[model samples]
Target chain A: MSNATQPTAKPDERVKEISAFRNALIRPELGGIVGTVAVFTFFLLFAFDSGMFNSQGIMNWSVVSAQFMIIAVGACLLMIAGEFDLSVGSMIGFAGMMIAIFSVTYGWPVWAAIIVTFVLCTAIGALNGWIVIRTGLPSFIVTLAFLFILRGFTIFLPQVIERKTIIGGILDVAEGDWLAPVFGGTIFKGLFVWLGEAGLIATFERGTKQGQPVVDGIPMLIIWAIALIIFGHVLLTKTKFGNWIFAAGGDAEAARNSGVPVNRVKILMFMFTAFCATVFAVCQVMEFGSAGADRGLLKEFEAIIAVVIGGALLTGGYGSVLGAALGALIFGVVQQGLFFAGVESSLFRVFLGVILLGAVILNTYIRRIITGER
Target chain B: MTGNSKFHHGDPKGAVQPIIEMKNIEKHFGRVIALAGVSFDVKPGECHCLLGDNGAGKSTFIKTMSGVHQPTAGEIFFEGKPMHFDDPRDAISAGIATVHQHLAMIPLMSVSRNFFMGNEPTRKVAGISFFDKKRADEVTMEEMRKMGINLRGPDQAVGTLSGGERQTVAIARAVHFGAKILILDEPTSALGVRQTSNVLATIDRVRKQGIGVVFISHNVRHALAVGDRFTVLNRGQTLGTAARGEISPEELQDLMAGGQELAQLEGSLGGTV
Candidate 1:
């Protein structure tokens, strides 16, 4: 027999380096980060009018971006798991309506209303999962039906409670003291008022007065968004359930043969998407102070766009919550930046279309290149 | 050249007890008979080659052995004990691992991740779950080393590897998981000459560990090169069995092509010569 040919150390090391480089390039979110940064830089340069493109304007953009970032994180997770949920918008509306109707109309305590809303929203999510799993129907159709059904319910349910177009008391929770410190705490303000009165004010308040800015306080929605993003990131990347999610989305048959419960993973993914919608609904109700059927209209599209732009493949198996967060930031910046750049707000829709198409093309090309299919 | 001499020392022997035995195994898909009374055995540490033309019950037999299909009749015995398997999971647990021709791996997952997928190493802290990625990567590297596979990295996607490397990974996975019976379904069918040799070498390595291997192939040369025992199946029946020394590569090829039947058909095609 001939001598066994061992691979040389130098060539082997080169191969290892190349493989690592290829892996880094092929990561799903890499495209999203590039797209986000590119879009952000484009808008930043275009809005060169110093009057509207200052620090305050940026801060205002961030506040708007935070909301979409929260929703996009959840949407990214759902998309990565290879499913879509159209019912998120409707779930948000229903959840907000529930909180408002219970707290304001029915005179229930704030905490009680919050608990009831979550439970009801979670049940709705479970129902969506059950329906999809049992019938093996496309989530798009299931969630689209859910969207209209929940919209109708939100509209009709309020009339039954108080015959009003708007449901109340939900805003108090958004501004409630119990959740305010965690979710809506004021920044740079009365808490440091004593320091401001003393000579320590300059060291503490370099950017604002009273060693505190009497900002609208941090909105509970922003806090919830950050928390959910972290939680979702951990769930999708580090658990056996997360592995099952990838396997189910990547190749369900292989996963099943490998002993993964494919059905259960799909059910869980759908439920998680619904849970996110419910949480967003609660935050919206709190932030706006009332629930209306129109509260979450078209937000589902926004969430989907954020997820897709964040580096999620429409065909699934690859995505990140962080990428979605960045995508949402990109969207928020563009939406607000256009107005600041003196572009007609009506033309924002056209800009979004271009960005969405461009993102999809870029993602496809990147995938091909990484897989050496190009 | 000599009769029983060839059958004695380093020679052909048909009298050895089978390590894995299938008796009167029958299977049907609705009204179609996929397999009928097919029986075979793989001796321990021996490379048993199963050969058949297309639609000759080869796939059905493999699926039955790998637990993809439960036989409608008869029994499968591992080491002389009758075994019943309900699913591929049961077969795997029973130490029967199948390396399919089309590849049964999720392409996008990393090599190490796919290697330890269903059996992930995990660490739990404060009610939160975390995969032990470091340990998984190390174990995967070790397993690959045993099969002489020098992967670029544990993080490389399985889809990016060469066909032979992928097969090596699958074989290594089987060996690592204590698979005493390795069932390879056309593992070298989709490879170039060099890649085919790599796979054959890997098979040799597997056999050296005293594992019973079932090598299913269409190429008689390839089969004869690695197989110790040969079994030919035609239209859901075992045509014949021969030890390595009992038959030459040409004879095996003829048998695989249905020796007498092919000649009879050729004779019928001739115009009364």
Candidate 2:
């Protein structure tokens, strides 16, 4: 209470020097780092013979982690911006189906279909934002409505067009398309081919496709996930808009009072989330060469679980993309390692629930220590 | 009645026009009238104290001026131009800053982040402008030092600071953002004596910088101690305006506590005590 101006207002010299290591320990990603290491080590112990630690195994997990990371990073950002997009999972399915329908059945070019999908996804995101802001309703409720709406549309659209739940022929469309390589093709295909020829990689035998590596090249999904994480990190920590997200999430009224345009920040966050879902859909549709109404089912919960495990506060205003990236890694290990260890795959969901609850409790406890909040 | 005391009123040197002139400002929340026909103004380099008891429409008046609540009737003239803010953002853009009672600080954010909440310092690096953390910390520390708050570091969380220290940070942030008119609502109501004195001193410092200040308070002593001009509000209406040395603290208190009518009523009903 002694607010009286002191004679000297210099920084306290007797304050203990903050060592580099301690400062690093208090970073928001600490729990995610520990969780990743623990999960990896546990998998290493149980699945060593399964070769989950080998290059091929690592690549497998990386692909799986990449799939989750692409969505989780965006979800993490949205969570930090103080919102939830339950519809993201549904958006992926809807977008994938739309892209396939537009390109293959409707006779549109692959790139044009992608462009149309982008516009449609952006509009959906904007609508979510507008409704949430205009009605002053919680985004959870609003996006849930979108979830059912999009899921129903995804199911009904394919049924009406192709007379089935699945939309195929996208792979055929992708075969001759110029942009296919950018979205779904392997990056080191030529290098892997050379490696296979040099006997550095395992290859198929007694066939026209003999003497080729088991894994041809890095999947674009992995590349996209890494890129998204880096982009999300920079956008969250280094930009003015990043500051706005933290401020808006931390205290919306306070942020608005500071002239942050909280409404616009939130709307943009919703759009970015939808945009991420669309990206995931585009890559996945091309990767699998087919789109189904069931595609990306329960993906919203997985992404959110990944984010929460990454150390984001559910109440909002705090999170890290790196943590989310590591969380996705942990998730990938848990799922793939269980299969490798002969454990039931169904157990992974239960494990996800426990990890989420534990990580959140740990995150909240750590945050309290850092903030010294009672 | 402009009798025996010295009062600084109307105009001060070089303050040709009032920095903010609010006339007949009225705010109605649905059927309930929060503020009715309340007019107040603050001149440049002057500390205008708005005195009112709880439920005296003081909060509503503050909200109206600061753009939390738009006036249903009357007008606000900022820098001699009539202005109606769509919200607080427009009010802030027009160079008016409001520090609410809670101070509107994000507790979990770092001091530097809180200091530069809406408008952070950024510098272009690698074709992208970053938050400029180094500059932010340096400036946050420097601004706080000017306000006589010596912190260990700018990265320290704001919630860990004392109540008074947080108030100083809020004031420093307000000043740093180039606010021409500063409105503080119940700044010292929740503060201790020493904190109150600190805030009063900060107000003195702010006033010396030539920015007009509207300090809302019910405590006559505190208001008279720091205020250059005083406007007392009652029942969503203004009792009157006075100035330093023009009216004693006792007279101002009477006016703020409900003038002669309350005194006469108390006499007729006999003292409850």
Candidate 3:
């Protein structure tokens, strides 16, 4: 009874001070950015031996990096929602095959084939979501089964339509002019190309018979990748669906109790991942003019590796779409850098494995420190 | 205590029904009967205390009331009208909010974010969505001020807050969202004496706002201090109900221990050895 009415220190003040301190060090995507930079620097150092330090080599690597970045961004969002789609690689091959079978074999218009293939691909994605929701089974198992199913379908699909192992219509989109400017176009011409060649004068152009600029123009894939990255960043940071994705992965039980439709969110995540795979398939088909069963083989592992390297937690709940795109860029740079550096192409797998493992370990330790678990 | 005199003068016609009423509520988890024929009432603007030992159906009762589980047999009336709740959302929509002992909050999320997690403010243009962080932060800070919670900012992660502060935040959030019937499950069980006082003060504040409060706690002294009426439950059954004036601290303790039943239990324990 001595001082029952005395004022005390406010609780919110203390909480705010501590939270401000925590925010200064725990950036959501810092780990991924750091890992990407580290890998890029490593490759850049080795790349000098094979003239990869030159502007032309840099432009070529950048072009190759763009495709992986686009697909990885979408994969990152799906992973953040607490599910995976191993069937993405197969979906890519299937979409490419569908476009080829329709446009080339059936003699349909390219635009119509593209639209139809996309619709069919989206349907396949919805089907995958339906199966997972109905069975209440692990998505890893379900999507793995789907991967095999799609692979078999892709191989047998051509035989059914054309009475042969090979299909002809795929070559049109892969090497066609109508889509070249959109999907397979180059971007580094005009001012940038002239500026890159200005300093080198005619000697640099003379060394190469083709008289191409010292640096090639930016690739269309790079433009697409940048656009996708911006869109994904906006979607993840500013949307209600983005918040739901974080909540679903953070704690499914708590989210469900809070009235979030966890099942629907997970299903939508899977469908989005599949849609990304289909988009990538269309791009690949345009670039290669062939829709073979092996078009996207093992690409799923690359996408997952990119996400993991980008600092996405294996257990979900924390990561960034931007980080995943950066990770894919790192992968592409390393792949092209090694080729230019005269490293045996067969040894690329070992090098990638080491880099991926290192990134995972670093990501785990950083996460632990951020959470104050160690 | 003069219950007959108070009954005659205080209640008048005794026509005012409870804001919430539960009768003959039975709940079972497989073979175990968690609650059997339990009944209780909460009057408006009064702090009703539910006292019990551990495993005396407190959790079961709270769950049933919050719509986590449908009671096996029961009649529940809200404002003299029968109602059915299929889920926690249903209870929430009905102005019945529950603050559990553990508190349901995402630790990694900030205070304001957690406060407005499900009911977030959004801005939409051309069917695309955008979260209004500025509005959310502003509204959350205003709510905190109204609840007398002095915080440095709304950006602090809720995990960093002390246990009593977290409970206060949860209670404040529920109250801000228009909860009329607030159920606090063991709110002070995990707190120290000072924190316990803070929670009791919060309960009093809630009652003063004309909200019916069901405060569940095992601490007899604390319950007696804040409670206007006390109901005792033993083995999932109602032992008795007593007005705060009708029971002394020691008498309430005895009733909570099952009085005669406890004496028989002591005798058996002493004789067996």
Q: What share of the true interface contacts does candidate 3 keep?
A: 0.19
Model 3 residue runs over 4 Å out of place are A1-8, A11-23, A43-55, A159-168, A171-182, A185-218, B1-17, B26-36, B53-55, B70-74, B124-127, B142-153, B188-201, B218-222, B248-261, B264-273
**Pairs clashing within candidate 1:** A171-A289, A188-A212, A188-A213, A189-A212
Q: What lDDT does the true structure give each of the candidates?
A: 0.75, 0.85, 0.76
By summed lDDT, which 10 consecutive residues of candidate 3 chain A come out lowest? Answer: A1-10
What residue pairs are clashing in model 3? A12-B151, A12-B152, A13-B152, A104-A169, A174-A289, A187-A218, A188-A217, A188-A218
TM-scores for candidates 1 onward, in order: 0.86, 0.91, 0.84
Candidate 3 residue-wise lDDT, B1-273, digit = tens: 223232221232346678888888999889999999888888888888899988888888978888888999999888889988898888989988898876766655667877876777799878876877788888888876765567667766665566777788888888888988999999999998877777777888788899999999888888987998888778898776777797777556656676776557757887331
Candidate numbers sorted by lDDT from highest down: 2, 3, 1
lDDT of 2 by residue, A79-123 (tens): 998889999999999999999899988989998898899899978
What is each candidate's DockQ, to 2 decimals? Answer: 0.35, 0.46, 0.31
Stretches of candidate 2 off by over 4 Å are A1-4, A10-23, A194-201, B1-17, B23-39, B67-90, B260-273
Candidate 1 segments whose C-alpha is farther than 4 A from its true place: A1-24, A39-59, A105-107, A172-212, B1-19, B125-127, B254-261, B264-273
State the interface C-alpha RMSD of candidate 3: 3.8
lDDT of 3 by residue, A1-374 (tens): 21332334455333334455556546556656776677668776766767666667777777777778867877788788777788888888888888888888877777778878878887888788788878978778988998999988988988787766556555544455465356656765775556645655221445554455655566677788898888777777677777677777766776676667877887777777777787787777776767786778888889998888787877766678888887888888888887887879878899779878987887777566544345
Question: Could you tell me how far off, in angstroms, the CA of residue B106 lies in candidate 3 after the best superposition?
Answer: 1.7
How close to the true structure is residue A24 of candidate 1, measured as C-alpha lDDT?
A: 76
